[model samples]
Target: MKRVMGCHLEIEVIDPTEVELQVAVSGAWDDGQVVESLRCTLDGRAVDVREVRDPAGARIHVLDAGPGRLVVDYDAEVTGRARPATGTAHERSLYLRPSRYAEADKFFGFAATEFADVVEEHGDDAAVLLPYVAAWVGSRLDYVPGASGPTDSAKDTLLAGAGVCRDYSHLTVALLRALGVPARLAAVYAPGCDPMDFHAVAEALVGDTWHVADATCLAPRSSLVRIATGRDAADTAFCDNHGGGIQLHVSQVHAIVDGPLPGDDLAELVAIT
Candidate 1:
């Protein structure tokens, strides 16, 4: 299925600041067919943007801008489904480690107590564990918009029992990591999302292939288009500023499939396109 995804961001730059944006669809899917574009402007004038590609294919748009109204626009028309591929040794090792939001190390006890039996039965089977983790997380947390903050961790979500999509992804990723499955988070454009914003979902490695696990279940996993990916939200945030200050004033995201959105089968392994 072909999907159209885009976002508009309005920001206030308090001073001369360096900005990094991960809002574009990843270049990992550069198969000569996907169409995408990104533009940045400050006070109606185009800003000089540098595109830096990460090892995993994330494109970071960087710029140095003085105080002004900064706006970013991105659009992508992604065609075809993602191809299944094996995880590299480095990827397997890296994602298994705990990160800022997905605190895998801190959840060993909780994982053992909550999912030990599933592990024993499925034995690192991502197909089974992925759905199980999604359901488990969906049951554990309430989808409260302001229930979590930027600094909240999976441990925090587990305690509060309420959060948004990122929080759900963090806890789901952490649980899978603690259960001996290499897992990470993917920030995506979800076509059917109720709140209509950037979404996060957990991805786990199973038998070499990586599969998505959306605890929020806010949209069909089959229709999600990947924007950025990492061990947690810290690595995949839409925007970041350093050595200066900026405030996001407005953000609007949109995604739509060319045809009807396909139904998702959580028990099946589906990679984010």
Candidate 2:
């Protein structure tokens, strides 16, 4: 499958600051299936964006830009059947614990009741719990754009019972972690996403592979292009600045697939490539 995606941002930096853009596709792209036509610029000029790759190969572009109006534009075409990862215990210890937004520990009681009987009946399988958690979260929440805040945790989302993609992902990750499954948040470029923009989904470890559990089900999980993955949104924000203030004048993102979107099967264990 082929996918095209990009984002445009206009920001007024009040002071000198360190900025990082986690908007590029993962650096683990297969060499043979190369269709990666990508570019990033500031004020129509090429900016020095250094590449940083995590242990898992997600890409983060970092640059120190000025106290001026910076227009950052990026676009890329990803062409390949994404490579599959063999699951390992290396990241399990980190993902199983509660983080800033996930707060898995806070949701343990709610999780016990939600999956208690199901676990007894199905024998505590991640494959079974994955889809069940996704469906449960989907049923509880409404897809309201402004219903959640940046600082909101899984507890906050559960109380509100309404949120966008990231919120749903946060809650799903927390709940799965509470149920003893190592799960984390992934920021991806989702082709065929409704109200298209960068999307976030919950990814859980089941046996020897990482499977996506998108409660929102906004796009086909198999078509998702990985941007960044972490404990939660904090580690995968599209734009983050360390110092000074930045005013976002304009922000836009678009993504689409080459042909018609593939049908999404929540029951299937699909990994985000």
Leading candidate by TM-score: 1
How big is the positional error of residue 192 in model 2, measured in Å on the Cα after superposition? Answer: 1.0
Q: Write the per-residue lDDT of candidate 2 for residues 210-264, one digit (tens) a residue.
A: 8888899899888888888899999999989988778888888888889998998
Candidate 1: where is the Cα deviation over 4 Å?
none
TM-score of each: 0.96, 0.95
Highest lDDT among the candidates is held by which one?
1
lDDT agreement of model 2 with the native? 0.85
lDDT (10s digit) by residue, model 1, range 122-225: 78777788889989999989999998899999999999999999999999999999988899998889999999999999999887878888998899988988
Error of 1 at 164 (Å): 0.4
What TM-score does candidate 1 get on C-alpha atoms? Answer: 0.96
Candidate 2 ranges beyond 4 A from true positions:
37-45
**Weakest 10 consecutive residues, lDDT, candidate 2?**
33-42
